[model samples]
Target chain A: MLRSPDLVGKSQDSLREAFGKSLILLAEDYPSLVVLDADVAGGTGVHHFRKNFPDRFIQCGIAEQNMISVAAGMAETGLIPIVTTFAVFLLRAYEQVRLSVAYSQMNVKLVGSHCGLDVGPDGGSAQCLEDIAAFRAIPNMSVIVPASPIEINQATRFIIEHKGPIYMRSGRSPLEECLDNSYKFEFGKGKYLSRGSDLTIISCGVCTGRSIQVVKDLKELDINVELINMSTIKPIDQKIIIESAKRTSKVVTVEDHSIIGGLGSAVAEVLSEYHPTPLKRIGVKDTFGESGEPDELACKYGIDQVSIKNTIINWLKNETKG
Target chain B: MTKSVKSNVNYIRSLIVSSIYHAGSGHPGGCLSCVDIVDYLYRYHMSYSFLDCDNVSRDRFIMSKGHCVPTIYAVFCDMEYISLSELKTLRKINSRLQGHSHRVAFPQVEVSTGSLAQGFSFAIGESLGLKLQGYSNNVYAMIGDGELQEGQIWEGAMFAAHHNLGNLCTIVDYNKMQSDDLNENIIKLEPLQNKWESFGWNVFNIDGHNPNQIREVFSAAMSKENQKPSVVIAHTIKGKGVSYMESIPSWHGSVKLTEEDCRKALKDLECTDNEIEVLMSA
Candidate 1:
């Protein structure tokens, strides 16, 4: 992942840090596992793996296109190479991922750090808001966006085990752990953080933590809302979403990415096709994010706890199915 | 005195032209330019056999300039990887042979390449993987002069050199012609040999059309003595064997190969009446 220089918060708190730490644990199980980087090892959080397994760490300089295809080639030789870089920079080699890795059906895993507006202060260029849409468009590509560090750790192990081309993303901001030690990552399944019957709040990535906080606060106000952590975006957890929608009759989705073609779009597609419900998508409304603090960007984008709570209160009071 | 090699090369050239003509559309000039290089590697230098194809340790070939897949098709046909009848179905609907390399459709292809410079990077990766796994297998990739214009080529070049990929040998079919026009006119890559050498590569300049030179250079490049990747700049005509299409930019897959054109091109390669009939019917 291409990471922007300088950090306002402690790097250890971010999902990328956990992703980097997870690689070290993964190295013990998979000896043939290699991590390819384009000068973003520290930013993408694979530095721990680099220090632990120098032989398996490939420093590919700043050539993303070369790194991706090279990983595809490595996969052909029975070595699983995790191609990690910034989400936006990975788009630079989308063609390579599509043809060599996905179309070839090579056993390669793609990890993108700083997936959304969670990449604070780096400005609009560094913040990759469209990666979800870009990656999900390609066929044979599995997309995963882990909500918390705990989920990313579990998700990392799951992606390595599931052979084929997969794209997993982590936010740049530090997120509170919503899942505990008993958490086990499942394929195409959404995890319910809390249960309720008033309304369902579906979220992924950094938004899941914020939605969880909003759910807790809403519970205090007697407006109980169920929270669903949608980690897998491609083969989405339609069963959980439809069931929640059926129970609550109202669904609101949130993410740190663009409202179009992201978690919101995917949820809308599933609900409209399978279970019709009153749904509202809470995210950046088709606009580029500027250089701002992490919390400021979240608040301004309407994905923060306060914004989500206010929006949900209004929607719950007004929105009704015919 | 390589009698069989000579006849096999001619037949490969004939297959390339006839297949393009049969499909009504295919890249001819670029494919013909790199035909001898691919044929020599498959026959003399590489351990790639049509018989024991499943051997992973066998030397691998990556056609980075995937638009020239017809070259690999013709070479594979001569090697009996696929039948002559299958070769005739190239670029046709429901055929395994696509306009470019599609590994999903044709499992024989190592990597699907139609875009430029990607196959070169792929070769670098495979080279690294083989070296890490302690296998002696080498990865041979062929690119065109025009493909050097892509940024990924330089990106891969730097990576291959930085990693010191000794098991990787890349050949540039420096025919100097792209789809629209000449390389110099489109994007100049002059002082090209210097570029590779400066990138820490073992560079060699040779005539791509000469069978002996192509085979010898590949043999020499297989050495891990220098512990560096090697690049061969094979200066060749855009269309080497087919006289009607040689050294001309328009023939660089931009023009369709009609039945008359195919027969004329096969005659230039000195195919006998029986050989020509066999190729036409197949």
Candidate 2:
């Protein structure tokens, strides 16, 4: 006797469609292209590439380590390889990525599905909240966190053309469509959803949508905040971050990963080295998550909009006190 | 080839004994084993220059078995890739000739290969990239018999075969011993030729220490017209030159070169003080 889950939301299906659309666009564009997935193809949204080009698609069947090494070899042999699996599975192949791909500077794209506590219900083992932080630690790696389905497709296209090792973190659930076919996408540029001088909210991936809402909620209290979508985590738009820090002088970094080494740390590293602005970090505080709903986990880990806004308000108050 | 064989063997043997004696530590067993193979490859089979080591279009040789680098340093010194005087500085601090071939220190070397199962992939990548860029150069990767156990080596093998990478040739020093133990006891890799042939590779088996067999097998591998990747499994001894150390695993990484041992090896090489003076001067 299993409980039937709610299907009332319009979000989850959009993520699936967005991921599929991106793969289709990639296959249409690159001739020397191939996709490799472990057993979880449907979960990773690589079914579109499998459907369109069965011959080019490789189902490596539960061997993530072997899949990554083979992908590196394929990339060596001039095939653009896109490998997809759960975030934990990607970590299983991290050593392969480090030596075989990154050390050799091979062009292979790794797509990590079900990233963060957003995975929900499958528990701490399945969800990979530490993925972005772990991936950004690797040198010469480009980390992309797509906010919505539209960005997932765009990120895929951009990664295909960018010519380096790419890690695209795709969420299990979806959000409001952030981009359209008419919308332009750039690799290393952070998009500004809102502009203000009082405080800057720099975030990426699913956290970007929440950070936008946090700014909106704060505006009702007369706190104007700038919102930045720092999607490319490595080779990050450091100039934009530095400029935002200098202009606002108050910054709040938010993400769905560990506060120790994720987006918060990346931003802090940039500011600590350069501007040294007043900053508040919002993310999981050095702890593993448990089985729960996505929103419930967000609340439990203080990842919701109210907590983000509260952190910003407290930072401002603390700076005034000093 | 026949005229240079006795001299090359004696020179490589003396180099192995002296270099290890000077270094005080090195994998002498494997290096002594692979000298004739490397000698035949560089002297007669492969095309390159000793004068200008920076030739862009020359064939590339990668030492996948980096622990057995006494052979490479010896051959390169014999061919003047570096000075024989520099050879005296093997395994010393700040020496160009380290325990492994580093591309940063040596320009002519292709990939820095201390890590196993990776050199083959780099060689394949370089070969494919060179071919794609319209360069008429060949890539040769020399992998040790025991190192074939690495999974990435198989991946490289599959990629090269599937892509029909004719420009790539891999040679295995199948000495049947690795690291003071028999390879079978560690990881059994038998019927080696069949294993490679099934992997869609054109396989050749040859007595690795025999100069004529080494050259003939390399030529046969190159003659495959369909341009498929080829593997030449060279059957070799662990330590071929020194009678006391030959085929013995204990001598793999241990240094046993006393002054008496050096004198004995030098006497076996049949060199005069004039040749030693010439070696020292140039």
Can you list each candidate's DockQ? 0.78, 0.17
How many Å off is the CA of A43 in candidate 2?
3.9
TM-score of 1: 0.95
| Candidate 1 lDDT tens digits, A124-183 | 888899888888888999999988877888888888989899999977777767777687
Taking all chains together, each candidate's TM-score versus the true structure is 0.95, 0.78
- Compute the lDDT for candidate 1: 0.86
Q: What is the TM-score of chain A alone in each candidate?
A: 0.94, 0.93
lDDT of 2: 0.76
Enumerate residue pairs that collide in model 1.
Answer: A1-A84, A1-A85, A1-A86, A2-A85, A2-A86, A20-A45
The clash count for each model shown is 6, 0
lDDT accuracy of residue B29 in candidate 1? 87
* Candidate 2: clashing pairs of residues: none
